[model samples]
Target: MSETPITISNLNDYIFCPASIYFHSLDYYTDTLTYQDSYQINGTAAHNAVDSSTYSDNKNILQSISVYSERYNLFGKIDLFDTDNHILTERKKKVNKIYEGYIFQVYAQYFGLTEMGYRVHKIRIYSMDDNKMYPIALPGENPDMLKKFEVLIKNMNKFELETFTQENIKKCSHCIYESLCSFSRLKE
Candidate 1:
């Protein structure tokens, strides 16, 4: 089988559970109940609105911009790309803490933009819930995180799992593929 493309979203699943990559690569998805959350629903709508909005070229905010990095073999859509200031703002519905995966994703975008010849000056995470912007400290090159992505990609392609445990029951509970994910350690 062909290898699956490593995406920015995979970082989230990898942080949650490496085995999830395997399931996702196989296309063995199940409609678990997590989508019913109102928060997620609202977040989707908000993202859609931002993505589809026909905002004039205000020379400040650009929404739903595509970014890619050939060096890291990853790509993703940035939520808000500030053109005038060269600041990439990623929007989240809510975040209690800035997780490693989030940092990696943002930094990857920064690297990608740099590789693409855009002078990305800063990166920030804008919490929609708090209506606040939290600046992210950019680390120029994250070989460790890139290596982790490589390992996960290799594991997924070879059907090799380093572990089969859920990161946490709470995370597994919120997973839409919980029903189909065999490695899900969520107890019945």
Candidate 2:
């Protein structure tokens, strides 16, 4: 297994295109190489409150807290954890569809917190755009989805840039690393 833990946030990107993660790791000056399109900008804006950790002084509400799962070797900051209700929520700028990637992210957070001795009653995806909440089943309650998530993690552990291929060409146009990726389907 790789010494570096898999980033929880990168789980979504991996589903989009594994190659994107490899290109993203390349050393490049942030200002010169990174592109912040409207979607990214909107996402940042949506996360500003949580990112700044400026939520009300309610002890039951935890925002922008880091979580790690030694068992899964995954780590990342979760958007919110409502201690009073034991609900973990991941906030997205907009959530048109409850993608498998999104579920995987919340599951990782759930597993991390549970391993750390926190009781997680539920997991959800909150869409800032539509002001909606989409609840997800717990890992034990959804064995099929859990199996898929496990397979994804296994694939990530074995990821190799040389052997990776872009299965969904349409994703390339939306990928930030398309300009740097040799497998990008977008025409220059």
Candidate 3:
């Protein structure tokens, strides 16, 4: 791999909250994710199916493994890669809204693959809940997308601490980690 890996600023854009990223940067194991992190785990499994589902040979897909970089100070796993494009991970929740964060996640994978000298063709978002996939191959790495991505990762390196918050949106009603999230206290 190159001395510095490709940048990872998209995560904050994905989450749509710079403060949340800031909280994570504080080295806070903040959430204390447990078996309660199952939704996330399930999303990961869905991504694994896509990453390793292989459209062909000579294109080796990987599971959850960090493609780290010392210079970029970036650390995140590729849910899928070794193909024409990369898929960050799968979305397990049954949602209709298009979560752009999936794109950021895929971009991170593509960034790492490119640094490692692989020709990335696209960034795909696979929703296992709906058995759907959206592939975005914008020429050579879209700069705007990447810029926002790196910005988020940069924010993640800030904040001394973080307090979790939630929306009363219908989506969060059945939250698995409700007991763990700080916001859950207020609901109680």
* Clash number for each model: 0, 0, 5
Q: Model 1 over residues 1-188: C-alpha lDDT tens digits?
A: 33344676566556656766566555424534344433223234446656776534565787766777776666776667777789887777776777666676677677667887878888887777878778876564556765765565455445447545565777678766677766666855
Looking at candidate 3, the ten consecutive residues that score lowest on lDDT are: 18-27
C-alpha TM-score for every candidate: 0.71, 0.88, 0.58
Q: Please rank every candidate by lDDT, starting with the best.
A: 2, 1, 3
What lDDT would each prediction earn against the true structure?
0.64, 0.81, 0.49
**lDDT of candidate 3 over 1-188, digit per residue (tens):** 33333334336232643333333333235444434333223354554444565433444555545675454555566665645344334344343544556555566666665666666555566665677766665425467866766665565555333444444443344444444345443466
Model 3 backbone overlap count: 5
Which residue pairs in candidate 3 have backbone atoms (N, alpha carbon, C) closer than 3 angstroms, thus clashing? 9-149, 9-150, 10-149, 10-150, 14-101
- Could you tell me how far off, in angstroms, the CA of residue 55 lies in candidate 1 after the best superposition? 6.2
- Candidate 2 RMSD to the real structure: 2.5
| Model 1 clash number | 0
RMSD of each: 4.6, 2.5, 6.5
Q: Judged by lDDT relative to the true structure, which candidate is superior, 2 or 3?
A: 2
lDDT of 3: 0.49
Q: Measured by TM-score, how close is model 3 to the native structure? A: 0.58
